[model samples]
Target: MRISRLYTLLLPAIVACGGEGDSTSTTTSDQTLDVDSIAAAVADQNLPSDSLNEYLRENPFDVDALIERADRFIRSKNIPYAEADVKAALELDSLNPRVLLYWGDVNFYKNQTRQSRDAWMKCIEVDPNNVDCRLKLAELYSIVQNYRESLRLVNKVLEIDPSEPVAYFIKGNNIRDLKGDTAQAVRYVQQAIELDPEYWAALDYAAVMLANMHDPTAEVYYKRMLEIDPNHQPTYYKMGMFYLDQEMWNESIAAFTKATQLRPSDAESFYNLGYINLELGVNDVAIDYFNKSIQARQVNHRAYYGRGFVYERMGDLIRARSDYQQALAYNPQHEPSRIALQRLAEKMAQ
Candidate 1:
């Protein structure tokens, strides 16, 4: 149950476009773009979020172009733009399945759960065999903890197309969430990989699940995932976490280093590096990492707490107390930092 809950937190139940305040760093280590990739993206008009003004200007009522632009906006996490495009598309053709699909997506990101569900339902009503919307509805049900309905939808998708990999993936995820039966849960995801060898989502779920179980076989899946999408932050972060848990110090550092290189503002990865070094009794390195974590994101209460722990260990009660107070300032509900401050106060009294 403990392992199950950990991975549940790790893997979000709802896979949707990022809302406001969600991480959407599209730059390199120092928050700069790769000039080559930027040039390539500019040249490649096929890129989802590439400027669509010319195309839309030529064919004002082209539902396909509107839907395409809406999808691109969604991908870019521009919910307002996406919603505008979705509205235009619906005005042009209210019954377009793709338009409905992205309408659901836009509403989902906006936290309008009922509207999102209704959009998807309307999509399925228009085209009963829309596997994408079906799978999406399944994910939605799972999000709302309606596991039985989620499974029913998954089973329906399987019946529609036995080879649908996402159906199997959803089944696996729902099983893990609903029942916490890891062994049973993973078999379905493995089946998903067997059906679609390059299914990145399934590979991630399977790899992370195995990692939680401390299974060395998780490395194989992680490697394949990196091969498929090397710069994916979650992959590197999760792999780093797995290595940290296994006490594979060098491996964890390398993975997290890559993550930080790709996303220098990733304070959590920095904090993990600090935690790992602290566990190894490398106080200097640990303090350096904790400092880096705090520098990367000043509101990172955990980083402050971690640095405080290192300070306390090094007999710097004043500094430790200051850090703890800073952590609490950022997040008053941070229990560990609160306890640390209390401990420091007691020590100072003595």
Candidate 2:
């Protein structure tokens, strides 16, 4: 079975939770800290870019310096330079756990999943107590639909640190996927949030699950998440979906409008807003939003179908037929468009 897009988004957070261990620290487990929080902390301590460049010039062969510079590159989303630094570090010490961890991060960002897994596995082999690597591997396994292996690794993480919020979050996802046990999944995710109320991933997952269960508390979780990170585009999209499910058209429109504002190029948000407007019998508004959706993604069959519907409603049969045909050209199996085309033909015969 294909994993849902919602679950797929969680993979990055799972893999990113583990950071490279500090070589000077006595315990290796400290290196497995949350990547975002660790990056924020390190950003304050990081040498300025010019200073790092000058230091690298003086000590070109220093492995720690190379990794530190690579970390800076990673934070800046410069994957190529980060990979080069990781490669340089690996050449100096092939078995360095920190370098291997960074290697995995770079590969993961580049969408080299197998390579990332290999790097993280090597890191674990070098230091079995690396909870971060284990968690990341579990996430990769889950992505590949190896739920049993994913659960085994996640359970190991819990054994190592029961309070680990990400571990609980993954456990919830695994249970939901493996057994369709949403109730149990919600409990596990709720535990994760209880452990760390500020965990945005867990909060979003919990809200989605609660919304699926038709629980009013889902809105509360969404509101809390927005309070924590107002600019999170995905949260707004999810909120729009939740309100759509509840048939709250105005609320859904508001949520999706915010999502579009946050991510102007995201065609899905505009498509959703168009759909809501269509449902509310606002044909002109729906057509305008659908046009915007198509502008954002020209190959969008749903947008074509939506515009076709609006044109048909306005008695413009020629344009309606053209759009329905365009929708079918994009997706021949689009049943609504197919049906619309057939009905248009029947009306023309009359």
Best by lDDT: 2
Deviation from native of the Cα of residue 129 in model 1, angstroms: 4.3
RMSD of each: 9.3, 8.9
TM-score of each: 0.67, 0.72
Whole-model lDDT values for every prediction = 0.79, 0.80
Measured with C-alpha atoms, the lDDT of residue 289 in candidate 2 is 94
How many clashes show up in model 1? 0
Clashing pairs in 1: none
Give lDDT tens digits, candidate 1, residues 64-135: 877776566555555565577678789889998888888777766666557768888899999998877787
| Model 1 worst lDDT run, 10 consecutive residues | 1-10
Clashes of each: 0, 0
lDDT for 20 (candidate 2): 35
Give residue 259's lDDT in candidate 2 (0 to 100): 94
